[model samples]
Target: MAGNSDPLSPRAKLAVTAGKAVAAASRAAGRGSGSVIGGRVALKLDPDLLARLAQNLDCVLVSATNGKTTTTRLIAEALRAAGPVVSNALGANMPAGITSALAGGSESKFGVIEVDEKYLAGVARDTDPKCIALLNLSRDQLDRAAETRMLAENWREGLAGSKAVIVANADDPLVVWAASSSPNVIWVAAGQMWKDDAWSCPSCGGVMQRPGDDWFCGECGFRRPTPSWALSGDHVLDPHGSAWPIHLQLPGRANKANAASSAAVAAVFGVPPQVALERMYQVQAVAGRYDVVQFEGRDLRLLLAKNPAGWLETFSLIDPPPTPVILSVNARGADGTDTSWLWDVDYTRLTGHPICVVGDRKLDLAVRLEVANQQFQVCENLDQAVQLCPPGRIEVIANYTAFQDLRRRVGN
Candidate 1:
């Protein structure tokens, strides 16, 4: 948020006003939250609007291919215990969305900014965050962006001069390699669900050696760092090995991992570990990720899984057995233009379940499901998909844009 003691320059103020007006107009027109365009206009007027707004902020930037939005939201909610907090609660991690988020919370004391992996360096350079959380890196937007190791190298090079204490996940090889270059780092043993992307070492390009929870490149002797905070079973363990069981409304192991990372970041901001965990429990959902919406007597729960890594985590959270599953996918600008990522995910996990596919790329998904021997029926829309199922609990898992489309269709 912009500081009260240090007000914005006149031109900057005009840009903020214009951005807010555009955002409000966007909301009224039902065009969508105007954070992107409004902030884009604001940046055009004041190219340094983000840097200027974030000048006095105690920012913590979170970047990961998956769980970034949820982790950012969890950290922001916990930081509220300290004081007014500003964050991109709407899952807008880019420059324009971030600008709108910071502008909205003018008097916020702390900023929890969710950043895209591609823009992490620039955002860190602009915000000068007090702490930076680098979650696991994996295959995402394969058609549009670099792989995990290359992206990790960019993180290593771009953040070489940063003074922020890096809160990195030691369980991920890519994250460890990137954060190892930093001057100050607080490692957390956050579990990694997917390992296909990190098979080759980032430092030496050798086959990674995995002995239980530890990973190292035998060629270069590059290994995982001992974490200050670790997740032991269902409990979160601190540096002293004292564990606290986390009770949260949000489901999935990914979210639990996110909670541990958020708690660690909150502690850096002066919020006690227990206090941060307790505050995080009060949050029932993050930008409709775990929302349960009722549609025609059946409870339709929403889940977002954009990439294979995300799908693996999300699949675990889905109800077992006869509980029907709705799989949605798209190749929109947000969900990557290439549909090749569909093959990376093993659809055989849904073998026994009644599967229904719906999305712009539903046919692509159907073809994949066919080869996996997972029988599925394609539906044109969510209503039709749910109509085909008996009234009970329905799990709707969708990619980026498809998830938003489902929310709008359900009036979420």
Candidate 2:
């Protein structure tokens, strides 16, 4: 295996060594937070480590309320046609994680980073990315991120001075408003399945008009921008009106939209549309979004849904009726302490389905399901929950920490 022996100044070299040692110790101690600590130590030692490592590389920074990790994986996979790409694939999306990824993969010629929504501007300013892909913005980590509109404002101010090309989602009014000021922008009509966050105009606080998939602000005169790249069913339409079929191993309309956004970013890097789509099909699982794993003698398909918007999209992918589903929730730091978002999800859609609630927040989920009149049993233990599931393939949808815990328990 290659070691992290990159050429750097004395202090940075020392910092890298210290960070790697810390990460190694953390892993040895069986702590899953090694990446987080390692990155923090590296940043503490050399504040400019991320920028220094990303200096001459063609970098693509992806940020959004959701789909950032999967989208980053898609973009990184497609960029293989160009050269070696370094990315933070471990789901650690902050500056520290990006630093660790770039510092560790020092030999790579390109960088594809999954940045947190709040840190996008700082990372972009530091790395001077070649392109920025702005996916949909929505309510996520309310305790930490506060509000979606505030994040949009931060992004708008941050990217205003950037010279990088912006690939933004036109279906989302917040994204449209954020990227509208960029000198070079490519609008993509990636479908937004959740519209609760974008109900009002970010510019003037007017109730947005939504007729089918098209949306416009009646008061501010803001509307969805015409997309240069769009997804029509399973086909991707190019800038010249030519359509190409996309086949992905990942499921959900959201993943298809992610593929479209990735293809647009790949185009900015001079990659052919066909090549980008081909590369995307090779990705079966991202981090742990969609993966079939064997747990307690049952084949469990893992789906991670962090918030209400995420749960809404994930619930759509579940097979209705007869198919048994496991829903898990946790109130850990990574999963967000407040579980109030549970009320926002439309659990009524699963009224007739066989549902099993599991995890620390299983009671909270059960309460929501009961209020929606959905019949479900509480199973705090995932192993027991799998055993109780109906005879057939079982699907497990879990929030942040719940998903990670299950993944670790199942040895995935």
Instruction: In candidate 1, list every pair of residues with a backbone clash.
Output: none
* Candidate 2 lDDT score at position 56: 56
Q: Candidate 1's residue-wise lDDT over 64-133, tens digit each?
A: 9899988988899889999998999888889999999999887788999999999999999899889999
Candidate 2 versus the native: TM-score?
0.96
Off by over 4 Å in 2: 1-7
Candidate 1, which ten residues in sequence have the lowest lDDT sum?
1-10
Whole-model lDDT per candidate: 0.90, 0.88
Clashes of each: 0, 0
Off by over 4 Å in 1: 1-4
